[model samples]
Target: MKSMPLKLALVAGLGLAFAGATTYAPPASAQVYVTQVGVAPPPPRFERVPPPRYGYVWAPGYWRWDGYRHRHVWVSGYWVHGRPGYVWHPAYWDHAPGGWRFRNGYWAR
Candidate 1:
């Protein structure tokens, strides 16, 4: 009989925990284009890093945040012909409270 009350209490506790976990508010999105002093200029242009001796296409350059400042960084794009039906999503930045956050580009099929 005593075990019944203990079991009920355990169930109630678990229900409260689950409810609290689901009620959490998500953090606000960060800012992406805030410029700070001492930020380094974009990296020098170089010959396109040839794609893997295959048919991969090259994507252009973009800016990225370097822990300290925003620096222009080139993420050499590649040709992905295997997935014929896929489309490339170019990389982008999101502004956050801290600084610019880079979202890596990806291929979508």
Candidate 2:
């Protein structure tokens, strides 16, 4: 009979402890939004282009996102006219907390 009262008190104590924990919410400053990682794009595409013409350089192929299908599609590489003192930077995908972000390649001097 005495043990029964002790058991009841133990259970009540534990219940109150848990209830107290959930009753309070963390402050906004303490909350952090985390982005989920996403599946990466498929393998790269291969294309054979003829020799560069008119000082054009080959910009490598890259993946493009298709919003309609919610997937990535291969964009064929093509020849672009070379800038006098710029370098061709290819497009690439970058990892973000919630998903992937596509960074467009550009001509960097």
Candidate 3:
């Protein structure tokens, strides 16, 4: 029957997918420290603030490209607990010949 061949193809495709699942690497964006994708990401959107909290510092939102989706996603800013003697450095994208590379945020002492 025609359906028999279609079912076989579907099974084969699924088999291949499962077989390669373990070997799949994270998207190139995660591994790339820098990119020259050419176009600059849009400016970060505004974050609303509530009354100041005692010990939390603000982590500003920024855009990170979803390489798999081929689009920019907004990483929303949030409050992080303050570390004594350390300043939280927000993540930012730097432009180069290879486009913008993301610098991960960190607490710099």
Best candidate (score: lDDT):
3
Q: Tens digit of lDDT per residue, candidate 1, span 1-109?
A: 9999999999999999998985553333332234433444454356566646453445555565555444565555544443345555655655565554556655554
Instruction: Return whichever of 1 and 3 wins on TM-score.
Output: 3
TM-score of 1: 0.36
lDDT of 2 by residue, 18-92 (tens): 989745533223222232226687778777877767867788888887777877888988877666666667777
Report the lDDT of model 1 for residue 20: 92
* Per-model TM against the reference: 0.36, 0.59, 0.62
Alpha-carbon lDDT, every model = 0.55, 0.71, 0.74
Global Cα RMSD, each model: 13.0, 22.7, 12.2
Please report how far candidate 2 places residue 106 from its true position, in Å.
0.7
lDDT of model number 1? 0.55
Model 3 clash number: 5
Order of all candidates by lDDT, from best down to worst? 3, 2, 1
CA deviation > 4 Å runs, candidate 2? 1-37
